[model samples]
Target: MSTPLDATAIETIQGFDAEKRYKHLVKEVVANRKIWILIDEHGCVMLNTDDEDCVPVWPNKEFAEAWATGEWDNCKAESISLNKWHSRWTHGLEDDELAIVVFPIQDQEGLVIYPDELDYELKNQAKKQR
Candidate 1:
């Protein structure tokens, strides 16, 4: 199965084509079918996935780290578990704690992961301990 990061790889190669082609590719990811799409400060597509585990989708770990350090703009990571979404700049303004946007992927009505809420969480168990 294609992981959440794989979705971002596809977008990087495809860039932003016409809507018809773009929608077709996005539909392949059940989570992106109804999502908004994440773009970096440079207007580049960031992440795309439906799985709750896959969020805060940045161009890469470097980009995510850069955002955390206030080096970039034009992107934000949303959490399907936290119910909140904010830009990199907004998130950085918070305390030293890693700010994340978590929300319910599925509300009472149905499941929907907004494109703007797209993000890929880094699987660094060792780092979490710090």
Candidate 2:
């Protein structure tokens, strides 16, 4: 049986186009154990989970740059255990935002890379090509 938290999380994701993390939770082929945590380019983890929906607050060029280079230290004062990458993004509102946490699809060589971090690096690299 699904808990109330699970149901609400699914509902929230359904309402948004991009922020919705649980958009595919109901599909028969969905991966139930998979979890994603949102983060900003600065490597500051956001406050939402894969099961929730969040609206991007604004676009930060610096934030984008940080993610691209895997420079999380600029955004976070404390050291982050997950060295792969992490991020922080504001919701449209001044105080609201979302973070999507993602883990490796499969553990590679016992090293777990955060999806948010990996995405930033990949995206950052792509941006440079253009």
Could you tell me every candidate's TM-score relative to the true structure? 0.23, 0.18
lDDT of 2 by residue, 8-47 (tens): 6534433544322222321211222112232456443433
How close is each model in CA RMSD to the real structure?
14.2, 16.8
Report model 2's TM-score to 2 decimal places: 0.18
Off by over 4 Å in 1: 6-8, 11-16, 25-75, 79-130
Which lDDT tens digits does candidate 1 get at residues 1-130? 3344565664453344333323333343233212232345664332223442223332223223334433434465432112232334324323322222222111111123343322222212113424
Q: Which residue ranges in model 2 land beyond 4 Å of their true spot?
A: 1-110
State residue 86's C-alpha deviation in candidate 1, in Å.
20
- Model 1 lDDT-worst window of ten: 102-111
